[model samples]
Target: MPLGTIVRLLGKQSQMGYLDEVYNSVEDLSSDYFQTKACKAMLLKPLNAASSHCHRLKINIDDTKPREVYVCKDTSCYAHCAFSSVPDTLCKCGKVMEYAGDRPENDAKTAAAGSDNGVFVIGSQKFITTDDLQIGNVKIKVLQTRINSAVLYAEVGHDFVDLVFGLLSVPLGCVTKALSQRLSKGCIDNLYRSIAGSAEGCMGPDYKRMLLAPELAPFFGSGASQILEAAESAPKKIKVDSRFSCFKIGGFSNLGRCREQAYRYNSSYGCNRHEFTYCQNTTKTAEICELDPKLHGVQNSNCDAYVKQGPQSFMVTDDLHVRPLTLDSSLRVVSEGKVQMKDLVEKEVALTKLQIMELQRAALMTCEALSSVLLPPKKKKKNLKHLMY
Candidate 1:
């Protein structure tokens, strides 16, 4: 019997005697996921199996292959997509992520290493905390924090905060995990755009202008205006070319990388999760090889290409407002004062040492002069001795 038929039958009657016998007859079928009590409960309200971050399922329209569509769970991804295989990857919220089903036999081992949304546990204790969420050595910035208060906030990139995502006074780790779950469901991009778009036509310059200025147009393209135009004109796709600037490929050197545009380069391995192309042969210069007219280049081939890469990884914007403590301009003043004081002390010590050395040399010269002046009668005694002989 079909699963749909069983569901329909289950809806008519709460309990069925033969259902258990039928389930027993089926091979490799477990009662854990299909308990009678669970089925009745699910009939009232559907269950969301995708809630877990370790495993996700992808369904297809056609039925040509087996029904194993399990993929990597990505709760914080911007597009709400899943990965086929686990690699060095991140969710849209900038959390270092791990997939559970990547290694089924050693699932416990994988959990010990890392978990979805950059969370993990060691022994019985969990590492999730509000003080700071770190991926490797890079500190994941907390946008806002309140001790002994119910309200807490976390920075999920693009200068946006995860407000109202956690309990008022819970440990920071719980808050981070809650925010990570929200981010995985495509909220990061939405919140980012909502906040960014609200700044348009404001009184002063916006965030994009502050980080990427007009002088950087040659390498990046354009700033606020170009992005606004792209958003307003085309909601789905944004074109990349020499006209617009301000797109930065993270972890990739933007020097003589792109064949057509010397400054535009492909992201290094693991830098761009999906290997997206910032430039293509669709541009006029790329079609005819304007940089060097001698060589014939493929219209869409030479710009930036990757081979056998994974699915499109969700991309996040950089946060420019928050800087490290060591680079704070206010702290530089105190450091400079301390440096000046140290230099003065060093110079004073050197001067004192030089004076002591000079005094010792002068004393030696004076002693020699005194000996010569006081011992003038020695030659007369020697002459008397010679006459006596």
Candidate 2:
């Protein structure tokens, strides 16, 4: 008998029940029966199985040969999407197709390392991995210079009360009181050296006696000793006017002569009195010193006439003026001070916005690629098989 004729006879005689029972019994008797039974037990199990296996039953709509039904296992239906063509067999409803191969996984480890290694480019600015530090050694040196300058200023402002009295023509006690309130410790130390040096020329015996005193002994070393020796070697005093007495009494002939010598000492030895003002108001003292003594003829003509103001003080100016610089002109303004390493790092990090954005973009692209690979494919209906039994 023909296979079709036999199948028809069996279908009609048992109403397809006998064929289904026989198929089920054979499936149960197999070693993989539990898997097969569980699959067949669901109302939608056959549809899922048919879809996954690319099985589809199609009735030939065309007038083709008898027993020529087509069972298509492979079809390409998702050929027009942006990503790639998808196989129809991947979907439950095989009419719907999808790109159903194992997707490429993103290399997250590579991306993170790349982000760390990537050059940060912003507008015309580009910094590489080697230059990623917030505060480098160069900036640290600049900060150190600033701190040293401050400390020097403090020492000069804190000592040498007698020098202030001699220069300002005030009483020694009054000068000491003013220095206590006005000068920083740095400023006073500087003043003591100046007074000691000047005293050696006219008051050499008195200056040496003071240096030997235990209380003032610490200031007599290295740089201070050289200044004292120079003063001690100079010629004795010639009496000048009482107004010019501070310079003459200290054994220098005049305030102008003392200042000239002081300027030479500062320029050669790095003893920068003019550059080391304790406060903004005291900067005027430097300006006054720089004027032509022959022309301006010294008003408060003592070498140390100017008061040293401490760190927190500033000179108040009545006028609000803005001075514009000429092209290529340089302004010689001193820096305010230094910042600590912690503060420096915080500022640098705050300024690295462009770098942070580049890293984030790289991370997002990496994640997007990875997500496409791990996610499962979508479902469709064309892969279903209609079991008439």
lDDT of 1 by residue, 1-389 (tens): 11212323355231222222222222122222211221211122211111121222132221211111122234333422222121222333434333222112223543443433232111233322222222111112221112211111112221111010001111112212223333232233343333235434431342233211211111011111121121111111122222111112210123123332323344674342534344543332111010111111212221111111122111111111111123243234335434332232110011132222221122112322112221232344457767887
lDDT of 1: 0.22
Instruction: Say which candidate scores most in lDDT.
Output: 1
TM-score of each: 0.12, 0.12
For each candidate, the alpha-carbon lDDT, in order, equals 0.22, 0.21
For model 2, how does the per-residue alpha-carbon lDDT over 60-82 read when each residue is reduced to its tens digit? 12121111111112323222111
Candidate 2: stretches off by over 4 Å = 1-210, 213-296, 301-389
C-alpha lDDT of residue 184 in model 1: 30
Model 1 scores a TM of 0.12
